[model samples]
Target: MERPYWVSLTSGYDRNEVLTDLMRQYGDDVWNFAFFLTRRFDAADDICQEVFIMAFKGLYSFRGESSVKSWLLTIARNKSLNYLKSAFIRKVTLLDKVIPRERASPSAEAVMFDRLESAELWDHVMQLPRKLKEVIILDYHYGMAIKEIAAMLQLSEGTVKSRMFRAKQRMSELLKEEREYGI
Candidate 1:
């Protein structure tokens, strides 16, 4: 029987090997979570890079109590919050004005089709309050268990459940309003 990759990585394994595997497996997830929290592409890139660096430096302290993905996401969430609080971040709004949005090519019909299909629901999800959005993304989009989410977010399981319920209620209300408006 083979041990799981993370199990081997945490059990006195080679540092480079463990770091490489961790980055390969969870890098995109960490980046996506950061993007969802920050809503800025550049910030997400910085957050993702910082997360891997922190994870590598703190690797020995990892107790294997949670899945590696959850641990990485916790780091990402903290870094994103810290970044949001920094004065340096406030000075960057000027750059937003200078950056031009990329235009999609006309040949990208599949991309357009997919966006049109999911954009409405995703837009509603994005409109949710930060806490509710985090819970919904972690639970539904990432398929994390409720217990894992509680551990990752440092919330009680009941709190996580309540947030999920509230998020669903809010989403339902948004959809109802859209329907009434014939949108």
Candidate 2:
């Protein structure tokens, strides 16, 4: 069977159809990258929305110099960084304290072992400096090649590898500390 018309980028697809397909293909990866950068759920949502808008508006200019996924992530990374620099974000500090961390039901804890371990690992990942954290997330979580991450972040391949090494070492130390303290 032939592929759907919208699925083939070579076809002269309408803007809306192309945009929709791009969103479906890249949305989760974009959102997760944004969330890692922003460290806040609401900001991730806003960044992801803005990314698609930018993608839609800039679609015609896309040169296909990289994969669409990489191009979309570059847009996402730029939007996320812009968000971090906004004055409104700088002045606001309410989300962390306002959001409750605990579950109402005890049943949640019953399944917590696996989830908690994963959560703790991510929490440590979050605590790393932004440079280190981004490397770790892109390299490990997103499974991108070091070369791709270097291009996406505009760093040298050696720099990306060095950052990844430091991130892993730091994470190991953090996990060891957690275990020693019985956290």
Candidate 3:
């Protein structure tokens, strides 16, 4: 029997079923990556949707130059970075209006306490400088090989290795600080 049209497209054809399969195969992973990148649940949800839409639209450009995972991730990374850049700009603009608060509402305090206790140690991963954060997330969190990370980031293997070393050192310092403060 002939393969279904959607099956052929998701397997690399011009078929709608391919899009559904792609979503089923990658939706969760992409969402996780977006969540890690944005650190905001709502923004991550939006970016995840946008990433898949962009991927589906550009499906025809998948010239077999890279694996489907890599291609999808490239799109996601670009979209997320653009969002971060815009958010940074907005943060800069709103700096005068934003103020740190010491007192929290009861609900806010509870939420904060819960996050403090329940958050993973590595949740601090996002607090690192972007350069170090990238290496740590790609190497340790995502479990990408050093060479693979190097290629993905367009850096030399030695450079990625050095960045990983610095990221580890910074992470250790951050963890120690967290422990000392009981956070």
Candidate 4:
């Protein structure tokens, strides 16, 4: 895909306008990838903010070797890893909070979600190893090509393809096991 027009502007682009444009175009992708990596809703927000700030500041240095979205993802991945390693994060994270809190009653959206057969697959997807999970999310959830994923994750194309294969196999096994044992 061609780079965004903003990337080509040599001058006269207002800083806010460039930042706004980046957020408008790729904000959801960045946020979702952050959420996938960190697995904490709160951490994802912080990571996304940091990702955009860094992206905007470093936009000039962006070498165009990868898509801007992948570049943002690399930033998100770094921020997420830093967050995960922080002492505050370690102190604040606990098993109880990591387990999602249930609402007092289901909302319409939740009720509708309950009817989807594939919803449970997401839970299984979460159980995969981090490497496998990352590949699955980037490839399927974000619709990233193998080359994009490899670039984002700094893996070889063959490695990315292998992880994708293993991730799907593991998901199938998880579902089969759940059906057999009623997990």
Candidate 5:
């Protein structure tokens, strides 16, 4: 009988084995979520690496309070937000040194977004108050269910749903303005 390739590849694996397997299985989806959130390939890569590092380090604390995917997503979201904040601070610090002008035009590949429009959509998303941005990113960008989002964000499901409704409505208006303005 043939052994499973994974069995041969690693030895004495425990529950941590499940994490490695899940990473292999859902890596692309997770990275895509990070990419949409960060709007930069390099930032997504960094966030994904950090997520895995965290998952590995914190594996011993797993309490099964939430699904692994949800837990991982919460980590990813926090990391991405931190990165954005750090980047924003750096930009602010350097604002005087850099020319204040429009950002460089997008590369041809950057113009192609699988969802909504360009990464500029995230600019509008960032413009939203934190509560709205959190809900929108969890529901729309991460494809999390309202119940899951409520659990993750510690809000009631009804609140999650309502916030999601308002987020989509506001996002619709923002997107329309973006299109009209060609931004």
Candidate 6:
């Protein structure tokens, strides 16, 4: 197969070319990950933009220790978690659940249906704690290897494996319970 566009352009490229390549290549993965972490479409949109903007601003400082994707994900993860923790967002999130937003045209129903299809297990995966959920997503959803997940989460390989095991076990139990009790 031919080498990808960004592979040749990894070094000594103009900022726009490099940034554009990175965004074009990894934009969906980063956005999906942000959405996985936050479960909010609007937050994912903001976090995706912030991830690329932060990547562009810090491009020069990138040491290439891990893959560029890993670095971008680390940034995305932090920004998403920070957004979740902000006091304003906490209140807004509560209000959002309690009070419905204005009924706009249903422009995003397609995206919602696609996401809901994956949660067809009745959102059992979504019920996993964030750490467990993220490992499952990175492993099963994104197909990252355990080593990569460990590095991204700053955990040891053993820890990543254990979490994966726990996530799988919990997911199985959740599914089993649902089947047995229709919960």
Query: What C-alpha RMSD separates each model from the true structure?
Result: 3.8, 4.8, 6.0, 3.3, 6.3, 2.9
User: What lDDT is obtained when candidate 3 is compared to the true structure?
Assistant: 0.69
Pairs of colliding residues, candidate 4: none
Please, what are the lDDT tens digits per residue for candidate 1 over residues 1-183?
A: 112655435546787887887888788789888988887777888999999999888877877788888889999999999998888876675566687466456323235436676768877988999899999999987889999999999999999999999999999999999999976
Native-to-model Cα distance after best TM-score fit, residue 115 in candidate 4, in Å: 9.1
- Per-residue error for 160 in candidate 1, Å, reads 0.8
Report the error of model 6 at residue 122, Å: 7.7
lDDT pick, better of 2 and 6: 6
Q: Model 2: residues >4 Å from true position, as ranges?
A: 1-11, 94-117
lDDT of 2 at 160: 96
Show the lowest summed lDDT stretch of 10 residues, model 4: 1-10
lDDT at residue 142 of model 1 (Cα atoms): 82
Candidate 6 Cα misplacement greater than 4 A, ranges: 1-12, 102-118
Q: Rate the local accuracy (lDDT) of all candidates.
A: 0.83, 0.80, 0.69, 0.80, 0.72, 0.82
How well is each residue in 1-183 modelled by candidate 2, as lDDT tens digits?
Answer: 112443335435578887887788788889888988887667888899999999888766776666677788888899989899988886563554676456466442234435665877888998999899999988777778999999999999999999999999999999999889977
lDDT of 6: 0.82
Predicted candidate 6 versus true structure: per-residue lDDT over 1-183, tens digit per residue = 112443334457687877887888899889888888897878888999999999888777777666777788899999999998899998998999999786456435336656675656537888999999989988887777899999999999999999999999999999899899989
Kindly list the per-residue Cα lDDT of model 5 for residues 1-183, writing each as its tens digit: 112433333334564775678688666656766766666666788898888888777766766666677877878878877887896746754673585545477543355453546567777887786678888877776677888999987889999888888887998998898789976
TM-score of each: 0.83, 0.82, 0.72, 0.84, 0.64, 0.86
TM-score of candidate 2 versus the correct structure, residues matched by position: 0.82
Quote the positional error of residue 112 for candidate 4 in Å: 11
* Pairs clashing within candidate 2: none
- Evaluation by TM-score, superior candidate among 1 and 4: 4
Tell me, by TM-score, which candidate is best: 6
Which candidate number would show the highest lDDT if scored against the true structure?
Answer: 1
The backbone clash count of each candidate, in order, is 0, 0, 3, 0, 0, 0
Alpha carbon lDDT at 166, candidate 2:
94
- From the highest TM-score down, the ranking of the candidates is 6, 4, 1, 2, 3, 5
Query: RMSD in angstroms, candidate 1?
Result: 3.8
